[model samples]
Target: MRPSGNAVPAARRPLAALDEPVRVEYRTVHGYRRAFLRAGSGPVLLLVHGIGDSADTWRDLIPVLARDHTVIAPDLLGHGRSDKPRADYSVAAYANAMRDLLGILDVDRVTLVGHSLGGGVAMQFAYQYPERVERLVLVSTGGVGRDVNPVLRLVSLPYMDQLMHLLRLPTTKVVGRVGAAAVRRLPLDLGYDVDDLLRIFEALPDAQSRSAVTRTLRAVVDWRGQVVTMLDRCYLARAVPTLLVWGRHDTIVPVDHAFVAHAAMPGSRLEVFEGSGHFPHHCEPARFLGVLQEFLAATQPAGHDTDAWRRLLRYGRGDGATDAGAHLADQALAQSHRTAT
Candidate 1:
């Protein structure tokens, strides 16, 4: 929504930077355009991005993990270079798109990592495709309970689709021009601050990026209160070598929410990044990658499936992630930089 006469900054913002291109494509069916970046080699790692973000959001962390993993990050159907379909915006829709993408890529088993809205999607994917997933990482995810981030409540509100359609248009340049001006007038509403929050949010308006923000929010309300409840319940039912990472200062999704997820998945370990916000990968890159690497590496397959993973899935003790580490140079190198799209 623009300001009175000119474009004024609204609550929505833009990313700090764009990412390097890898492989790009658009599926004709949903007009889903995507980019694939391959990094490192060991086990395959599939990355899911947060709402209002593309695979590029992982730019700072991908290279770190890439050293140890064949990372796959896509720009979901309607984000990045991805096509903007006239429809399909629900979280389930996002998961379905990922399922299709994975099938096309012929990925069998993967360690799935998701952030923010992406985290919720990761959990949902694990629930639906347990056999395909080797392990799980959820960063500041939802679907745990009612303690949603305040800003998220605004984005997840019902009837936001019509609102999205009306506002999401023009290219990033146009939106940026107007948004920056409006931001000058708009008071900062977000409660948390790592830096100049208003200045960062004023950057929104990149056509593809902005549209993504619009779609995810509008379509998220499409759930009708079913899937959120389902995923929350599923967390307790299935334990897939889970690793929960959260930032103490995450305003988008509070760090406290990790407690609910940790409680849900009995054996899952929660790592707290002190002073970091929603984008732990960005705010606390080194630590985030180290913890992630340690967890994934620990879950690597031995001659036999590990007891830790089995124990996590409640199938007896199984081999899996959640191992704390002091050094993860190789893993950090691959995952530290580079993003999915």
Candidate 2:
């Protein structure tokens, strides 16, 4: 699909040294400027980044994936180059923004790929507009369970705004960088995630960005863990081709959540990267790309059937039971797995 007239090219930048330069563009949606990276041409692949991240998070994969498919990676509102105005930072709201952005670009259907918080937004989008999604790819996705990193939980607490303001101070920034460097030197799984985590931390130095992060975090997390979950609606994944990729060493969102989510979503494929942490795609780009390409080649793009969707929504996979029953079963299974782990 062609981008609409209002889709203005912002600036051109090379995604990587080995890759062709990709165009970063802007389109005003609802009076807010939205930034996105659009490259190559074919069937569309919409790549959504995690919280506190921009479209550039997928820079390595974008060049490779663009060779075979059009890749559209947008910086979610309140992140990266996008306008960070005070607004609804909930997953549902982010999903709506994606829908609007896609519509503006005249994209009808997409193979949706989301990471971290973006995964929750993608699932919500599929739930709200199943007809527009051809497939789903979730990477270390949140909203699968009540388990999340304590750092995020702390960020969701009150007074974090003031605390984050302090993070912007030069002395604190230097200390943070030094601490991160020190952590990376340790023999721990967390070292794999230090750079990525530090990037996210550095991005939140400003008040608006920090507030956005806090609001987004609080929407899905609390002092304990993730407050929202997709287990109840995972049965709907039966209609859509789904792939779940996780790092076996992921400390931010436990790898167990991947197993639980895989079980909850029937027919979903799960790949665990042994040496990686939260950001498997970044840590193991080659294998991640291979698995993604294989999945895309093997599965047929799902066609939306209004009647079938309605039935699935009403009868829960047509197994002679309501979705409520399926939800309970999923919860029990998830609980059992959590306990066993």
Q: Number of the top candidate by lDDT? A: 2
For model 1, the superposed segments whose C-alpha errors exceed 4 Å read 1-31, 155-212, 221-227, 230-232, 235-239, 301-341
Per-residue alpha-carbon lDDT of model 1 for 197-303, expressed as tens digits?
33333334455555556666654432222125322234322446778888787765556567655654656779988746666676666677779878876764312
* Candidate 2: regions farther than 4 A off: 1-19, 317-329, 332-341
Worst ten in a row by lDDT for model 2 = 2-11
lDDT of 1 at 289: 70
Q: What is candidate 1's local distance difference test score?
A: 0.58
Show the colliding residue pairs in model 2. none
Please provide, for model 2 over 168-286, each residue's C-alpha lDDT reduced to its tens digit, 9 standing for 90 to 100: 89999899889988997999888878777877776664788888878878878888788777777767767799999999889899998887777777778889999789988877777
